[model samples]
Target: MEKIRLRDIADALGLSVATVSNVLNGKDSKVSPATRIRVLEAVEGSGYLPERAEVLLGRNPSRMVGLVVNDHPEYSGHPLEDPYNARFISFLQRAAVRHGLELLVKTARTWEEAAQFASIWNMAG
Candidate 1:
């Protein structure tokens, strides 16, 4: 099915596109409570799902975080070897969860792959 547009809601409510946009984007502090409720009901009836990243960015605290670790001698070798990297990742995951953020760890197979992965995930050493 096709997605609904902000203009559609604006036209339906007899409001300007900018006003509808502000309400939908949750920057409606200047808008009246009745107008806010109308906008919310319109969104629900239209089955609109806001982008997760945008919503998270709008919140006081974000919900996304990333972690990356290069190859350490302690974490390399046989699977039975001491799982230092695994333990560290688990700890980081727990800490992130406690703070309401997600933790992602990725292992790169080569230096080139590692560089590419870092660029993709926006990580820096």
Candidate 2:
């Protein structure tokens, strides 16, 4: 089967391609909850992948920041479960937004895992 396009998703959902594009681009304020859920479901169920041009355009405006947290043994599998980590991340997120950056968070259970995640995402130090 051919890879799904934004137009194909829009046609299936009875929405304009721009609307679908905005939804996929994380502009949720422009879409209603019902429409947003429908679009999300359709995208997930159909396995939609944005084209390279679309991906580049989306990234061109801002930089992507990846936050990889290694869960501490005392934190029960997630460092964010502790208030300190949660608060720290919140501050980081605010700072990133203020600087016009996109934040991507992931849990890295070990040093190896963190390295793998960074390499996979092409993260900058």
Candidate 3:
């Protein structure tokens, strides 16, 4: 069996790669139901799996906020020892959910590692 790329499927369906990519990634905002179904069928037949991060990055922000909690021992102890931090984190999560936004949480052991991760994820605060 031969592997198929997204471009190949798009070409076969007489659609632009971006249009096909959007359909495969589940962006239904600008896509009609009929077109979405067709693209999905083509994708299934082609055995192509779109990259999730690429899809996510292309999506419009829906009140989504990424949170990075540096829980290093030097900063804060276990949740049992520092209940305030835990409570704050819980509150943020609840607030994000209430607003229909996803909260991405990341923990780092070292300050350097935290900085690097923050930079990579564009979560600098």
Candidate 4:
């Protein structure tokens, strides 16, 4: 399949590419809420992937932090069930939101899986 670009999203939402770019770049103050919703919906629905270069350059609002926890053999239940894990995630989520970042929590039994997940998502620790 062809890669989805910002222009495609803009066309899908019937908005200018510049407007979509602004929204994705976190400069949406000039864009209307309705338009922003439409843009975001289109982006999500189309499974659009922004340019990695843009994300790395901090041009896009794709600042994401990955939280990896390893406690599989010792713990039987989900990681969220642990009080300490829950509290840590809560604090991390709050900090991420406050700084306009996205927090992705992933639990892996092995280092390989954790590394794979982080590599796939281009996540920063």
TM-score of each: 0.41, 0.48, 0.41, 0.50
Q: Residue-pair clashes per candidate, as listed?
A: 0, 0, 0, 0
Predicted structure 2: clash tally: 0
Candidate 1 lDDT over 33-123, as tens digits, reads 9997787677658744444433444536545566646655555643223477668778888988897777766554456445334433322
Q: Write the per-residue lDDT of candidate 3 for residues 1-125, one digit (tens) a residue.
A: 66577889989988889998776544657988888778877776665644543354454643556665667676565532457767887898898778776676667665544543443332213
lDDT of 4: 0.76
Q: In angstroms, what RMSD does candidate 1 have relative to the true structure? A: 16.3
Error of 1 at 30 (Å): 2.8
Query: What residue runs in model 1 are displaced by over 4 Å at the alpha carbon?
Result: 51-92, 95-125
* 2 or 3, greater by TM-score: 2
| Superior candidate under TM-score, 3 versus 4 | 4
lDDT of each: 0.63, 0.73, 0.64, 0.76
> What ranges in model 4 sit over 4 Å off?
1-61
Error (Å) of candidate 3 at residue 13 is 41
